[model samples]
Target: MTSQKLNTFLENNLQELKDNGLYNEIDTIQGPNGSEITINGKKLINMSSNNYLGFANDDRLKVKANEATDTYGVGAGAVRTINGTQSIHDELEAKIAEFKHTEAAVAFQSGFNCNMGAISAVMNKNDAILSDELNHASIIDGCRLSGAKVIRVKHQDMDDLRAKAKEAVESGQYEKIMYITDGVFSMDGDVAKLPEIVEIAEEFDLITYVDDAHGSGVMGKGAGTVKHFGLQDKIDFQMGTLSKAVGVVGGYVAGTQNLIDWLKVRARPFLFSTSLTPGAAAACIEAIDIMSSSTEEHERLWENGRYLKAGLKDLGFNIGDSETPITPCIIGEEKLTQRFSKRLTEEGVYAKSIVFPTVPRGTGRVRNMPSAAHTKDQLDIVLETYKKIGKELDVIS
Candidate 1:
């Protein structure tokens, strides 16, 4: 077939996405991703970023990045195994180990890559994985890549996890079993029941993996979910992102020194991809310093989350059962959800609507990410706008 014919075939398949209001358009941010941001020449109170601690645009991080770039250049120049491992990368990993209260840590290019690399590196086709139904896409992909038997348990249902874990181990058909879950569910902001999970893992001899992507800077006073449950020693894998909370770009796995060493030798990304830039590595170290020194940013973030969630609830929107700083205003239909997001942007709030495929169909939502950088006055304005939009859309009485 001709190239033009193939293009037409692809375009036809995409028509359904457009017709169902699932087609996503890219929006360019004109300024720094901060409490308030410029998009399309309009300033909006940004609520869609994962920068919960608001360190992405922090002056200290910027200064550190500049200094590191001056000292070590812009890139690491080769894959980690082939002379790409800079001193700063080692220092950053050490810093992360200290921050996570682990014996050692390994950094990857992104959180997605970390999951893809670590999970597959640890388990093989002979093993089995008991995963949360609502775990992130990265975890799902990693399990698939591992050549393991992937069994998904119900979200946060310890009973289901226990049952599946027991079945996997008792059958004795698999060489090993790993139980994995998101430390914090990104969409609903609900924390994983780590204590219960750890107990089950112990009973079944399953390796415990917790992806704390959204929990790192927002839970357990910034040490993450393992710390939140005081199960740091019990969890086998403590996966997290420097991009989201730490305000830089990278992902990490924190565990025993042996685990870190194994990953360094076996993880595909670590062996094959270039290391994180010196600037990002240095900035991430600085972020860990900030998170460890005090809880001021974390406190400010929760205060803002509570304030905004309370305001939205008072207006009668269906804010789901989110126990963390991540909040979602559940709007039923995809079109309505997108319209709601558009209205919020028009009224100067930057929260984006999430629809099917990201969540189950018909359970579309507008996810709000409150940051430490947002002042009370800014949150108040956001609340007022939400109230106005909610009333207009009949989302609230």
Candidate 2:
């Protein structure tokens, strides 16, 4: 039977969240997630997906996925350590390594698991991790799970990172030290200062890891943020996801052959969880090939981002300091932020509100993710709706 205490705890917390406008109401996308989406049978401009290159529903990827599915069954039979490692999985890893300019790579079931497994695999109670204060939730949890002493470095503050790194090393309490940060901060859309970060890492002999989940397929002509800074050889662990720009589902870490080999045997998620399905592996391979060969999608994505950002800025909306395509329309109050997003949906755009926990309280925003699939006409409509909603809601005057 359900525990009575559990029921009471859930009831109280759920009500409190709703009352405070902290509760997120998930919208059901009735069709393929693309430049436009359908929710509750109504069509809306889709600006809130990680499908950066518009490859999520691309025919080429779908074709490859189908072929792989026909050749191999739906799921890998077991974990990679056992008999689950399929041929396509090997091909996918190789493709990832080549694309990321690394000697080798290892795949994970998801981006979250990739961080969880990779961090704990090499770090432990004897180590300390210096992480960006605004790093993704997965990175924070990974640091915690490693049982390491986690030091928070101020967001994009290289001076703070250097100080903390020196302190951690000089403390002499930890056996090893590592620095982890997101290649692209998804919220503000600012990128990590990789050149300075690498210099600091070298000075302190610290292992460096970059989780480029948003950067891949969107930066360095589709290679990622590390390559954007020409630091592929400098970073130790180059972690990324196939689910975002790759338009598939999986995560990977590309580095030296030895690093990947260690993760293959040591990362518990790889050892215990089932490998990615053959279809997904094949689709990921296709996506990497597309990224390596063409800049069409990548260029288009940037264009769309610029168009949207200019529109919002011209309309006097506070779109934070975004270096990438991710644009956020900052709305202060929680209820007002949620209301803004709702009004946007009613007016035909699908931008969603990001509140506290996702972002800091009082910094609530309507995060817009512009993809390559979006056309000028669609974006124009989105801007018009935004202008109307902005003035009406007093989010902008």
Candidate whose lDDT is highest = 2
TM-score of each: 0.98, 0.99
Candidate 2 structure quality by residue, lDDT tens digits, 131-195? 99999999999999999999999999999999999988888999999999999999999999999
What are the Cα lDDT values of the candidates? 0.93, 0.95
What is candidate 1's lDDT per residue for 1-397, written digit by digit as tens? 5799889888987898888988877799997899999998999999999999999999999999999999999999999999999899999999999988999999999999999999999999999999999999999999999999999899898888888888888898999999999999999999999888888888988998999999999999999989988988999999999999898899999999999999999999999999999999999999999999999999999999999899888888899999998999999899899999999999999999999899999999999999999999999999999989998998888
- Cα RMSD to native, each candidate? 1.0, 0.7
Residue pairs in collision within model 1: none
Q: Which stretches in model 1 have alpha-carbon errors above 4 Å?
A: none
TM-score for candidate 2, residues paired by index: 0.99
lDDT of 1: 0.93
